[model samples]
Target: MAKKQSNYAYIGIAFSLLVFGIIFIPKIVDRVKVGDITRNESRSKKVLTNSDPVVADLMYLEINGVPKKVPPFSFVNQDGDVITNKDYEGKVYLVEFFFTTCGSICPRMNRNLVQIQNTFSDAEDFGVASFTINPEYDTQKVLKAYADNYRMTNPNWHLMTGDKEAIYALANIGFNIYAGENPNVEDGFEHSGNFALIDKNGFMRSRQDDFGNPKIFYKGIISEEEKEDEDGETQEISMLKADIAKLLKEDLVK
Candidate 1:
């Protein structure tokens, strides 16, 4: 009877180690290989160019057939510092819009952003930024508290709040994420649930479909128009990271 109990204990220890390895091994291996993620993507080592067709409509204006560089933007970060496109020059960044009081998808979206931050927080060429739709409520002090809650102290990770119209304008015309307030909605607000990938030159990250063809994810979101998916957020964070990594590997750095 003692021998059987001892065997069970050993099996339990082995199961615990297996679970631990399953949970952490991939993240660790990914951190070690972070630099190589982009290189491992497409077979060609050729640098990305403006001429490359964008994967999303409404992300950029097309002069001919290529995605045009978005104009510079301005906002105030949690620390109350003004941030502009000039602030992100030569950096590959991810962007999103959320409100502090959101009780649903925003939390999950933030979790994904946190993962993105953790994955490449140390990469000089990479950064993450989020804009608050509720600027009136998400003051610098409120934003600071929210950032603290997330333990987001990296100088490169910016949680920003500014003029409500200004934030909405940038969301509508610049980043393509929708921002608006609707009384009918449970939270009296609506915004896109996407995490947009911006290239070093400020163009949204364009991607190809499974057959290596350009596929537009979305254009800018307008008021009274919202997209809902039964699958919730369909795009994978891994794919978004790979897109960012691909942009990092681009030759557009100044």
Candidate 2:
């Protein structure tokens, strides 16, 4: 009787151990799988950090192995002809928002854009487009004058103007920048002086501020201090120029 009791106790102990192992093993495996997934996601985020903040975010927005769609736009160019999204279907473009009478930073931005045009003059895939935030003031004639002032005669370079509301909507909502009437109403319409790089597929890949540096613009927060910087004269065009080159080079590889 005593031997039987001892045997039964041992059996019970073994069964308990087996049951515990069965319950805990799946949990352990699940934990390992979750850990692996977390590690891969972290690695991916790290890999996306590059010179262009917008491009860096684009890594997460890719669908079917390509960046997401770029919104369509319609505006009048320097020539007074209507330009639409269809015209830019197969071209990669550098886009900027500016006004002809912007005494602070518009000239510098145009100069930098001219430099970009010169850099990619031989590349048939690349072009430049500037949309006037003050469309009422920057009519086709005004944009034409502005383009000529910058010596921008490239058939591909388009200085554009359109309806006031349409231009404001594009600046604020489309490109995700600030553009509206100034509270003081003395400084004209307030809009970001940043250049956006759009790929051939029409995805906005990058944005660089007026200083021609990608580092100046953060995705979510555009600092008031940065706006002040745009108001000042600064010669830092090399950084933005390099970003354009990088984008072109990457496109070439694909």
Candidate 3:
């Protein structure tokens, strides 16, 4: 009986220590000054991370510096309507890829997107398009449910999926984002977190080539304070939101 009582006492002490550590470890961590840490300009200036100049497929017609045209294809959206590149004409859209079951960066990316949608809820010409990398599982029903789960009711925001081959081709050969099955990757599929911004004329907003030619989708800007959660968006996303407004204004003027 005494031994069992002593064992209980030990357990109680251990639990108390755990609780105490949980209460103060973060405070200790906050005060542990390793040294004077020099931070690079806290503001991330127009740093386009993935935007690069490149051309593949001979049909790669470009305009004013970004890939102006994309391979024609049709995909079903959450509303079950077939959306083709033609639907994107005269509109500016942000496109990206993610699986419904993604447990990593997708959540963060999607959260950023949610803020973006809210930021420009009244804009008719701006849209957000998301493609399911795991089309096999992300069926129309699943996509709709996922969008609904996030309160994504904007008619312009479309979640899509179609022929696996066509989608993969569009991800790789079209958007320049590598989308395919990779046994080495945690999700069994590899893709970029970068979003492609397509402009009103179907040309992707992009950087110019050496001699002045469209080459690739404009790279997004990212900064060091990107991890703040209160703003509900990353620094890069903030930059994107600003750029989207710039493009929308440009469209209105042109």
Instruction: Give the TM-scores of the predictions, in the order they appear.
Output: 0.67, 0.61, 0.64
Q: Over 4 Å off in model 1, which ranges? A: 1-66, 210-235
True lDDT of residue 249, candidate 3: 58
Query: Which digits, one per residue and each the tens of the lDDT, describe model 1 over residues 68-166?
Result: 565677888989898887787778887788998988777767766776778787778787778999988989999999889877756777888878888
Question: What are the Cα lDDT values of the candidates?
Answer: 0.72, 0.67, 0.71
lDDT of 2 at 6: 100
What is the per-residue lDDT of model 3 for residues 72-173, given as tens digits with 9 covering 90 to 100?
868999889999887877777888888888887677667767778888999888888888989899999999999999888678888999888889999987
> C-alpha displacement of 54 in model 1, angstroms?
18
Two-way TM-score contest, 2 vs 3, winner:
3
Query: How much RMSD separates candidate 2 from the native structure?
Result: 10.3
lDDT for each residue of candidate 2 in 62-94, tens digit (9 for 90 to 100) = 445654455788888999888887677667776
